[model samples]
Target: MKKPAKILTTAMIMLFSLVQMPLTQAAMITTGEAIQAQQRNIDRDNLLSMLQKDELRAQLAAYGVDAQAAAERISHMTDAEIAMLNDHLDEMPAGESFLSVIGLIVVVLVVTDLIGATDVFPFIRPVS
Candidate 1:
């Protein structure tokens, strides 16, 4: 009984010695910044969701732009750029002004293609 008790005590001491507490870090984030981050995430989701629509995909295809590629590029865009885009989208008048939105899509595609970020149009050779 003494031997068994000694062995158990030794084992527990070794186990406790080997155990380590996890290190944690905490940082203060301003309320405005947190709100901005959440809004940015929501805006990005909305844009990505918009890109998922079949009609939008068809329209993009008609302009020689790949919807998947557009989504990929959008994923790489900065938070500020995404916010700007979302703001523009929100400002667009509803109903008959959809052509303007299409125009906007084409322009964005062309610009990205020209900038070498995308290869949607064959005519525009991205800057080397």
Candidate 2:
């Protein structure tokens, strides 16, 4: 009877050890990989949030456009157009600097005329 009880206890111990082995092996995987996977998930969530924001979608819709299409078009725009868009993005809608902006535009037009690239402004004629 004593021998049978000891054998049963030993078998139980072996079974418990076998069950724990895989859990220990699983923990040995690198923590960095886990963190990187979590960050990728978070970035995906943030991208979805930006795409689904109602205000942004409404602004894009006001132009008879879809937000994703507008974003794609802006991404593929020429550098000059991108710069203009950036400037527009930086402006406050209710701010009053129209005259200053108009003056700067006039100066640019004059310079372009002087350089003979444009002929729209007649005050400065390009040299032949």
Cα TM-score of candidate 2:
0.30
Residue-level lDDT for 13 in candidate 1: 91
lDDT of 1 by residue, 1-128 (tens): 99999999999998887785446788899999899899888888888888888878887888777888878877887897787777777787876334555567678778888899877788999887
Worst 10 residues of 1 by lDDT: 96-105
Highest lDDT scorer: 1
Name the top TM-score candidate: 1
The local distance difference test score of each candidate is 0.79, 0.53
Candidate 1 positional error at 102, Å: 3.1
- Residue 43 accuracy (lDDT) in model 2: 43
lDDT of 2: 0.53
Runs with alpha carbons beyond 4 Å of true place in candidate 2:
1-52, 93-128
- The C-alpha stretches of model 1 lying farther than 4 A from their native spots are 1-26, 96-98
